[model samples]
Target: MTVLNNTLTFRRGLTLKNRVIMSPMTTKMSFFDGVVTQDELNYYSLRSGEVGAVITAAANVQDGGKGWEGELSVASDKFIPSLSRLASTIKRNGTKAILQLFHAGRMTDSKVLRGVQPVSASAIAAERPDAETPRELTEDEIYHLIEDFKKATERAIKAGFDGVELHGANTYVIQQFFSPHSNRREDQWGGSLEKRFNFINQLVDGVISVVDNSNVQNFIIGYRFSPEEYEEPGIKMADTIYLVDKLADKELDYLHISLGDFKRVSVSEEYKEKSIMQYVHEKINGRLPLIGVGDVRTKEDAENTLANAELVAVGRSLIIDPHWTSKVLEGKEDTIRRVLADQDREELMIGNGMVEFLDFMMPERLR
Candidate 1:
């Protein structure tokens, strides 16, 4: 067996049976009201057991933060029982379950928020076509939002999840606050690089405070971030390195770098010599465990990723083959599905909503 099967333990005492992790992918299978549904449970049940941990799709921390129609929510106590079932389903056969928390920020339109104007650190519209200018969040609103994240963590703990991943990547509310292109405010929450970091710094502290006070033991807290942004004045590699340095000091369990290709170098004019993984890993310098993911489909790919990251996260590969890890563990890698076919949808437990989403975001994957 390759080193991919090796076990890993976090500083906080959470141990994984192996280095494989199921990266969180939006299934859009939850109820319209954001409650976990049976379809969602079945999807996780089929994929959870073989991996070390499964990070569920982004769940909005507040009602106004909802990004899509079928996304999950941990904003209130009413979701605990449903979320409990989800955590139990994923924890089968020694697998760890982590719920991802996020808010869409300006990424969502008024329609998604039921006519409520989307909020962000600054009143700016995203660069995308037809993007609506979001209302700037007030100081009181920002503090309340941090409290919302804390309450979400409490809900995750009560639901028996092994951890919670703050979705600070992909231009979400957290990333929006950190991105100069998105955050143009002059308040304490914006302006200088350190000021922009105020939102996530406080958010992480609030969430960690919940874990510190919770009765649960070894409840992990991880942060996911995109290493670079495309827009000028956006998050450059230097900015991300600074963020990594700051995060290293925080008591986080892991840092999951979001990338399209694990081997990708900096897209910015500067820092193009090494892969994003190598750069981030160098900055981390063994201070925290990192989860690396991007187009990891084969055993060799995962093993290679292990060279840089503490854990390897497989997303599309697992969606194409629910038993991807099991097959790898059993020496059946030759039989694993490489491309997703239309006819395999039912057996794959892929919902219609997810199918539609994949069609839009990753059309080339579906054949």
Candidate 2:
């Protein structure tokens, strides 16, 4: 029971209430123009009170970075008012809100972003054929992208979010550079792990400068990382430890960790069989608050993870049951739904609202 009582408050100057965080789960319910929809608002609001912090679904920083059709975007000012409204709604329910800024890198389908060639650390394609072959980022282009992240952070702050989380996990642009298999560049932003992490470091520095870290109470900057590159064999716990040590110097507020990549999607069975969070917790050793996200389904599981890690992040489990946190806290774990192991991807429909909304927002040819 002490483990359940142990609340991990993520704080800069102020504090979030508890250790339960709603991990960033992509809900492609954004209007074609990037504004959040009513359905999106309802979805987040449902989970707000039960969790300590709510990290909004991935919002692309640049037009080229856009991966899916209905993903939220902060590429322009016109989208801010609606986004602000969504953030306000989440905060009204007593949860700290953070926006996860993302870039798909080569994982983006060319057909989606107006035939734009995806960009990455180097001219490498993701292991999947659906992913486009990315153009190697030029020195000028890399700097421009960094500024794009800075501007997005400013927009997130204006939109009433408490802080921002860099989407560096799951074979995204940042992770692509961090992993040796994808990043084969010879420049300053490539080669060694330290050089590979330089882009993320620069992005963080730019964001911290704009947001005024001290003034923004409860200001949290989280980075999501995957130590085991599901696509390649080389990435290990040691690599992740090195990455965390470097990021700690940058003053990252939290480290959200999970396993697998776009190439090797982690299924529920694999998650239950392995202690991914424990491995990550051992590596972190309390340097920064560790956020453990995977297949955390039961309250007991969440409590166990919290005993070892700073926070427990629930993803698909919450999608299946929005009141999952409250149910677990109240010892009603039996009522919580578990995502089926053999469930078809199409049948799962976690972000179904986006699919329904996209039909009315954009025509099929454009979508």
Model 2 weakest lDDT span, ten residues long: 259-268
Q: For model 1, how does the per-residue alpha-carbon lDDT over 1-367 read when each residue is reduced to its tens digit?
A: 7777788888778999999999999999999999999999999999988999999999999988998899999999999999999999999999999999999999998998999999988898999998999999999999999999999999999999999999999999999999999999898999999999999999998888889877788789999999888887899999999999999889999999998788998877678888889989999999999999998988888988888999999998899888899888788999998788788888888989898767765678757
Give the true-structure RMSD of model 1.
1.1
- lDDT string for model 2 (237-308, tens) is 567767777776666788887642111223334444346566556667777888776557677667767765
lDDT of 1 at 102: 98
Which of the numbered candidates is closest to the native, going by highest TM-score? 1
Q: Model 1: how far is 178 from its true place, Å?
A: 0.3
